[model samples]
Target: MVDRDIVGGNWIEVPAGKYKKNARTLSHCQLEFNCLYSDLISHAAEGDYSKMAPFRVLSFDIECAGRKGHFPEANHDPVIQIANLVSLQGEDQPFVRNVMTLKSCAPIVGVDVMSFEAEREVLLAWR
Candidate 1:
């Protein structure tokens, strides 16, 4: 038995034009239009032609200081910096670029550098 409430399960092909027309009329549904939109794109794609949805990607890096000649341990090492870069799916440049440093740091061009006096402050800002 298949659960009809689920967005996907058994495959059934519907014409793109008909699907779009009926999908637009769906309102106050448990599933939002955005979810249906994604489903439609995935289900309606043809050979060598697919709609590319715009999405954002957030990439982050954490810097930690460790003891000499040893790998940084979570309990022992302190996080010195948290760097973040956010960009669109196909964009070459990241629109949001920022870093939260534990202490003083030199200014960087095209990047927002936030230096906090305390480690807690940096962690809070990153959060």
Candidate 2:
């Protein structure tokens, strides 16, 4: 849904026009108005923004969690760490950048896959 109104959102609330909510974050957004726009996404996850002429850009780092140091036999999660965005951005890139680190790295909740124990002694007896 295209929600332009942010009521009691712990942020500013302007009259409804057009806006997009930031992925993985609440109350953060990119406002849509004059400049240039694409109706293609029409309210989806992406908004191609090169609205200005003479696209001279400076790319800040892009952050994401990805797999690295794969050891086939070992069952382990990938190196879950912040990697150098500079290498990822490429040597020719204008700015030296890496994934952004926010002071408030919001709590991320993983899917619940837990089995509750039965009444007292049910689990204890099994052990």
Candidate 3:
């Protein structure tokens, strides 16, 4: 269609006059519109290059703490901690290695090993 849809507006019908006057030159233009107000009447324009967006690669490892003096079992053991290594499209080193755990533990000086009181808290924060 010649007229593209704008989301988050509460107008009853298309403002045809406004479109004809203000948006005539927007055809084939790579433009971004943002809602400037809660009612969504006002909009600000910008440019976007989503076509050049790069893919993000994420690497991670799971650590399950088995019962004392026992081997970790996938079927029964609980995941006590999670470690993540995130690499952006062109980073030399994986930028971040974050770890979250259930039980209270000593912190590593430079690592992101955060311990929570309960496993449910970690899962909720991730969600």
Candidate 4:
């Protein structure tokens, strides 16, 4: 068959052998479409390596206070702080940097520090 290149990639039309009428999975969730793995590989798009897309990346860390000699557990341990840093692709400096602490915390240069009275408040604010 001749290859047809669409806007983003080539289009491959395949016959719906069995999944034509009932397109829902066993869990009763209707999917956009279902196809076999071999069918996908046959119609895979060619990669474009000339340019890269710009996107934001977020990196975060969570600090918890747990019992000594024990791994931190969500139900048992209390989250003390949550630090976040968001940077743009191909950028030198991070666009957003902040920290949410359960209690009062020392200020850091170039970072926004948010202190909450309780752990629930801090977690809620982070969400």
Give the number of the best model, judged by lDDT: 4
* TM-score-based ranking: 4, 1, 3, 2
Tens digits of per-residue lDDT for model 4, 14-47: 5567334444545433345565544432334546
Off by over 4 Å in 4: 1-53
Q: Per-residue CA lDDT of candidate 2, range 1-127, in tens?
A: 1353222312332334445544454432334333213321222222433222233444332232334664422233322223132222324553333322322243333311222232222222212
Residue 34 lDDT (model 1): 31
Backbone clash pairs in model 1 (N, Cα, C under 3 Å; residues 3+ apart or in different chains), count: 0
Candidate 1: list runs displaced more than 4 Å. 1-52
CA lDDT of every candidate: 0.72, 0.30, 0.58, 0.76
- In terms of lDDT, the poorest run of 10 residues in model 4 is 1-10
> Which lDDT tens digits does candidate 3 get at residues 1-127?
1133343432222333333334344444344332223323322232442133455687777677687888889667877777777777877877777788888668876678878787667655443
Model 2, stretches more than 4 Å misplaced? 1-75, 84-91, 99-127
In model 3, where do residues sit more than 4 Å from their true spots?
1-51, 67-75
* Clash list (residue pairs), candidate 1: none
Instruction: Work out the TM-score per prediction.
Output: 0.58, 0.19, 0.49, 0.59
Candidate 1, position 41, lDDT: 27
Relative to the true structure, candidate 3 reaches a TM of 0.49
